[model samples]
Structures are given as C-alpha cells and as structure tokens.
Target: MFPLLEVLKSLAQLSLAQLSLAQLFTATVIIVLSPILTDRIAAVRSILFSNYQDYFFPQLTMIIEESDGFSQNQLYAAARTYVGVLFSVSRKPRHFKCRRAIKGEKLVFDFVGEDFYQKKDIAREDSIIANFEGIKLEWKSRAKINEHNGETVSKYFELSFDKRHEKKVLEYYIPHLLARAEEIRKEERVPRLYSRGGSGLGEWLSINFEHPTTFEKLAMDPTLKRMLKDDLDRFVKRKDWYKKVGRAWKRGYLIYGPPGTGKSTLIAAMANFLKFDIYDVDISSINSDLDLRKILLSTSNGSIMVMEDIDCARLEKGGQQNKASSAKFTLSGLLNVIDGLWSNCGDERIIVFTTNHKDKLDPALFRRGRMDVHVHMSYCTIDGFKLLATNYLKIEDDHQLYRQIEVLLANVEVTPAEIAEELLNSSGSSDDVVLARLVEFFEQKLHVKAKAAELKERLKSADIDVDAEGLVKFLKQKKLENAKEKEVEQLLNSGDTDIDAEGFVKFIKQKKIEDAKAAEAK
Candidate 1:
C-alpha cells in the first residue's frame, strides 16, 4: 500500500510523455477499474444507510396487482383511473407516455374541449407523487414479464406512504380512490346494450346505449324511485357484507306492467344510474336451458340481464306448452341461473324480468330469493302525468288544464306512453293547446270506457259471457236477431199467412235459412 501511494504521488508530479511503459500500463488499469470500484463502494454504503433508515423511519407499501389469479384486481384498476384523473386535474405533464383515446372510443372532453384525445392517461410503468390530507405518497407502476416468453405476466402498483399513515391510507385514501374512479367511469362510459348476435351462438353484439332516462326524470312514484336508489346504494356498498352472509352478490327485479308502460325505460334508467351494461335476453331465441346457460355465462360481470315479456316464454313444464319440451327453456333453469349455485359465477349482476301478465307466471319464479324486488308499473297517475308534462313540454308549473286532466286521470287508466304520445304529437302547439289535446284524448277514452261498461252490463243481464272481442260480435248478432224478429212481427201484423205457434217456429227457421243463403250469395 505504501509503495502504491508513493507511485500515485510520483505520477501526479510526472508528465504523461515522461512516464515509462510499465507506469502507463499501471495507470491504464487503475483508470479502467476506478468507476467499477467506486460504484461497488457506493452500493455497499447505500445498503447500510437504507437498512438503518428503514429500521427507524420506515415506509409502508401497498401492492395492487393487475390480476389476482382469477380476475383483475379492483384496486389496481382504480389506481390507474385515479392517477389519470389526478394528473389531468393537476394540469401536469407526466414523464411517461400516456394512452391516447382512439377514434370511435368514447371521448371525454373537458369544459374547454381542447386536446380531446388525451383523456386516457393511464401509464404502463411510471411513478407519480400524490398528496392526500397533508401526507405525501408515492405511487409506482411496474410490469413483470415472463423470461421464457418475453410476455408481460403481471402488472402492479405500489402505493408507498409514511408508515405512520398506514391506517388513514387504508381506511380513507384507498376508498376515496375507488369512489373517485367509479365517478370518473360513470361520467366517461357510454352504457352498452348487449344482444345475442346472429353471427354465432352464444355471441353477444353491443351497441352504445344512448337512452337519456334517469331517476330524476323517470315518471314513477317519487317514494318508489327514492327507495330504488337507496336500495342500489346499499347493494353496491355491501359487497363484503354479502360475502359474510354467504349470498351471491346479485339482485333480481321483476317489473310487471301492461303494454305502453315504461318497463324498458325504467331498465334504461337503472343502467344509466348504475353505469351498468344491459344484456337483453330474448328467451324466444334461446332454445333450451343449455343454450340459456351458454348465453348467460358469456355475459360479463357488472351487467343487467333483461328478459322482457317473460310471461310469453315457455316456463311451465306441462299442459299444452309441453309440446316440443326438450327444445324449450324451462323455469327451473332460469331460477338456477338467477339464484342457484350458478349465480355465484359472477358478482354485482342484476337479473330483470318484465311481463305484461304477471298472473300468468308460475309462483315459483317469484320465490323469495329468485325475484327479490317486484315493481308493478301501473298506469299513469296524476303525478306521473305531471312528470310527463314537464318532460315533454318543459312545463314546470301547473296549467289550467291540469285540474281537468288530473280528474280524468283519476277516473281512467292510461299508460305514460300513451300520454307521452299525445303530448309529443301536440308539442309544436302552445302548452295550453297541447294540454287541451291531452285532456280531449282522455275524455274520448273515458267515453269509450263508459260505452263499453254499458254494453258489458247489458250482456251480463242477458246471461252472456262478455269478453272484449265477444262484446262487439254479440252486439252485431243481437242486431241481426232483432231485425229478423221485427220482420216476422210485421208479417204477422199484415195477416200475410195464418200461422200457429208451431208453424211460426218452422217459418222463422225457413226465414233464417233463406237469410243465410242470401248472405252467402252476397
């Protein structure tokens, strides 16, 4: 060591040209190894310092991986969204490249609507700083690749914060991120409606669901609407509670209503409110239970599966519906998918059944856990009409015709769709005119209902079984019989023939035959 130090001192004093070949070679070797030796010493020092620092002022890191062996981790997805929103809101340019929204994808424009394509800013691997409630946090994103395949096997985010803030980070910051991410998704996502495509069996086709229905604008009972919203809130927040109770994280709703009522619209409102996709299941197109399972299992989680006009579906096992039994879907299969073991396949799923004739359905379908919520979409009430008036005509305050319309609505049963049509048809006119047209339509409907009631009562007095179509047919037949009797009475009064009671019956029969022949000839 002393000799080396003397050589280094002599080299500092000597000029480069005067150095011997052996000295030059020695200097070259020292120069070559200096950076490597320095790096090694620094690395050892860093390790020791890190150990001491970690032992005293430690940090806690929460790792959220992209996949949890089964599915994508919810926290990982939320972190990605939250980080993107954070950067955008902070108005800061990040070092890593951000994902750009491509054409045909839903674009979320800021208030200024500039740089529209930059909305998607999720990075594959990057680090960002976040400050939450006076605590500084570092978020690191990383990807792990498979060495053999050179393909990314997993991606993760590390949220590192001061160990003292661990509880707050877990209890508050994580939840806040999830809530904010959900809000961002709701704002940016275009609800998609899925249907079975003709291209392949069990394949789904999606289209952007642009229905504007919302709970605020929906024409339903206010109390019921509030209850539905509250129920949804409870359902979404009770994920862990559901697991504790051993219940599938799913819900079933049976919406029964007459035609022209807003069952489908209510479903659209629910989807918009929840930001869930709609899968309209056409049971007629689904041949058997196996086919139904294939279709249902293909649907993603966090979606609504709707079976409209469920009463028309072949649910009953026996009777006339038993023809081609093997080819038809059954109620048991539906129940299994909705509430049985198969329901555990997905989480946060909603099953909706709509039927015009609820009474026609089997009681088993409405068993406690199967169809949990039953919503009867009744005819439009006074409140419903007011909602429609406000929606269609932008009429917030009550008009002079409101009282009359309310009275008519009380006495009659008209669906919201019918009222909407009336209002829509007269929308170009004044509010008064539009409302008056609606009132006139209501009065006409009332008059028809009154006439029908009178006819129905007359038929009952004559001991006739009156149905809607039968009433019209019976009226025409009664008119024809009365005309024949009048003609026979006129012949008797004219003394055209001396006919006894027995002969009268024979003559009437002959007249009936002739009348039938004449009608056929015409």
Candidate 2:
C-alpha cells in the first residue's frame, strides 16, 4: 500500500509541473503578441467608429437634454470653463474656444473630454461614465485616453476614445448658449423697460431731450450707456421681427425742449447704442405725406428714424387745420408711421421726433398712446454743466474751474451747445479763464434775451402786434391817410377838411408801443 501511495504522489507532481509549464508558454506567447493585438484593435476601431462624426452632434444634444439643470447659462459657462482649463497651465492658447473643423468634407473634432478636464480632480476620477447604448462601447476607448503628461486614469475606464470635447464646447455650443440666455433676459424685461404713457405730436419737429452735438460721444457717458444698454437689450431681444416670434417691436421718442439742446444728440446716441442705421426723415424735404410714409415704411430694423425741428415742418406750418394739398399727405399719413400700419414694418426700430416748440404742436400729437416718453431738454442745469465741462474740457472734478462752473450754472442758461463750443475752442487755456469766458458768453446771450424781452414788453403795452419791426414803419407811413380820413369825416359835418399829420404820427407811434405792452402782458 505504501509503495502504491508513493507512486501516486510522484504522478501527481509530474502532472502539476506539466500544467505549470504549459501555462508559462501561453503567457510568453501573449506577452510577445500584445503590441500587435493592440495595433490591430486600434486599426479596427478607426474603421468601426469612423462614423463617430455623424453621431457626435446628436450625442452631444441628447446629453445636454438629459442632463438635469443644464440651462443656457451652465452650457455657456461650461464651454468657457473647458477651454480656459486647457490653456491655463500651458503656453496659453491664443484661441479661447473649441469649435468643429472641416477636414476633407468631414466634420472633425476640435476638442474632446480628454483635451479639457484632464486634471487630477473629478475629471480623472470615476465621475465621467461610459456606455454603449448610451454609446457605452466608446466609453472604454474614451477613458483609455488621458491628458498628455502623466494624468491619473478616468476611473470609469482606463482611457478615452476622444480628446477634443473642449473645442466642441467652446466653438459651437457656448456661443449659442450665450445668445439664447440674452434672449431670455430680454424677454423678462419687456414690460418695465420704459413706462408707456403720453402720446407726442412731434412729427412736425424733432427735439433731442439729450443734446444733438454731444450725441457723437454718447457711449462715453457711463450713465447713458447703462440706461441705453438696458433699453437696447429689451428692444433687441424681446420682439425683433427677424426672430421666429414674428413681431416687430417698435419704439418712439418725443424730444421737446428749447432749441439747441441735445435732442439730436440723444437720437445719435440711441443709434450708436443700438448699432442701428440712421434714417433722418426730413418732412420738409419730402414733397408729400405719401413720400414721408413711404420713407417710414422703408426704414429697416435696428434703425433710428429721426424728424428734426418737427414744430417747424412745412406740412404743419401753413395752417392750423390739416391739409393734403401739395403735401399730398395728411395728418393721418404721418400717424401711419407713428403707430399705425407702417410702424410694423421693422422690429427694433426707434422713431425720434424733436421740437423746440412743444406748445405749438397739436393736442392730438400727445395723446395717451402715441409717444412712449416725452423728454424735455430744458435750460442747462448744474449737473448737465459739469458733464459738459468734463466731456469737452477734460477738466476733472477737483479742478477750480468746476467749482466756479457750478456757481455760473446756478444763474445761467448755458445750452450744451454754447458750453461745448467754449470748451472746444480753448481746451488748453487756464480753467479759470476758460470758465470766465464761458460765463461771460452765456451772460451776454442772456442779456441779449433780456433786452429782447424788454423790447417785446414795450411793444405789448403800445398794443402793437407785428412779426417784424418793418411793420411799425409800414403802418407809420399811413399817418396822412389816417389824419386825412379822420379830418374829412369831422370836416364833412362842419364843412371843413383839416390835416393833423404831425400830431397823428407822434401819437400813433406812442400808442403802438403801449399796445405792444398789452400783448406782452398776455
């Protein structure tokens, strides 16, 4: 029994040795052919997954839709974040975003996951998953690829199939996301962008509530920029006719003020702010109201349509009543441009009407729904003066001239144009002298206005009403006619004709001045 047992042990030992040797040989064969196998696998994949370009976009879209809370903001932010990560520690990529590229009639990747989040944090860990039906087959391939330079493995897989996700996020996805986000933001602001009240009949005039000459540099005004940015954002995104929303959002401005204020400037600023073309509709230039309506209808979106000095429009200038004579255009024709049929021609359009004489406009012009807002560019106020000083003179707030300017602003009616002209002519002069000169100029203009007022008062007290001083002399020439007529009437009853020319002339001129004074009183 002992001999048989010993024989069994030796046979078992021999069987174990032979099995170990066979396994070793198999291991040696695999180790030697591993590179070839790997190359074969790569070649096969290059063909099998060659259609990935076709699937890339669809896959990305699906992923985005499936992801929770993947809003436009997050998408836009992600695109930027991915690209920024790629260039941060490197030589700094000149291009900040990733995009699709065309290679031989094929869409190719600019970035993939490995190219972006290749760092040692969540990206290198098991956070990113791989799938087949979920494109799971590509998962192992993708996780196999890592950031160049000793990155940790993507725990979901050893490598990745692609490394160009960064490019995709940056060049294609993020931009659209930002644009959509802006649209959403605009939609939210449509109701409160401006108050809807008070129609304006400024078609006969264009008054810039802000000033015209100063409008050339409107973006420089930080406050104006902020306000305008908000307005424009609402104007553009909410109801642009070009969008699928199928509506043209139009705006109208009524600028009423004393002459030479920045009413025109405000329009220019609005144009600049909105990146719009300017279509100045000169009603006087148009032969008829039909031409004016045609002009308004042709105005494009993102355009500023202006009608300057509307109070003096030839159409409204001739008579108090509306006419369609040579004008061939009626009040109704202009209304079509204001808020009627033609206004819907373009979305994101702004119509601005400026007038120096708001009082002369028709009451129908300023009804409840015509003009969106009426801005009055009144006499230059103290704050406005400082803005002019800083804009035109390059004078800082700390300058002594600013303090003196503040003082003059208290009592002066310096229009922005007047102030602008002074600062421009002598920007290099001492602040004190420049301000003194400015103050003197405004004071002189004021004095001229005062003298004109006094002359008007004298004319009113004399009960004289005339558009020009020539009328006074023209009437004075009739002194003999008045005397002869009066003398003849009196003499007819007494059988005598008497002439009192000298007394008539002296008394008439004095009485004319008194009548002028009465008109002035009214």
lDDT scores of the candidates, listed in order: 0.75, 0.53
Number of clashing pairs, model 1?
0
For model 2, where is the 10-residue window of minimal lDDT?
A: 189-198
Task: State in Å the error of residue 76, model 1.
Answer: 14
Which tens-of-lDDT digit does each residue in 1-522 have in candidate 2?
Answer: 124445445556665556677665655566566668778888888866866754663233222211122111244323332323323333422223344322222222222444445442343321223222223212111333434654423312222333345455446544654565445433421111111112221222222222233243431234544655576667667763436665447766788887667777776666545545566664555655566655665444446777777666534533332443333455666776687766665556777879998887666667644666677776676667766766766665666556665665666666777677778897788777888887777667666556546655665676656554663354444543555777646644654322243443456688778989999999
Question: In candidate 1, where is summed lDDT lowest over 10 consecutive residues?
Answer: 109-118
Best candidate according to TM-score: 1
Can you tell me which runs of candidate 1 are displaced by over 4 Å? 1-187, 317-321, 324-327, 472-522
Segments of candidate 2 deviating more than 4 angstroms? 1-232, 240-248, 314-327, 401-404, 449-522
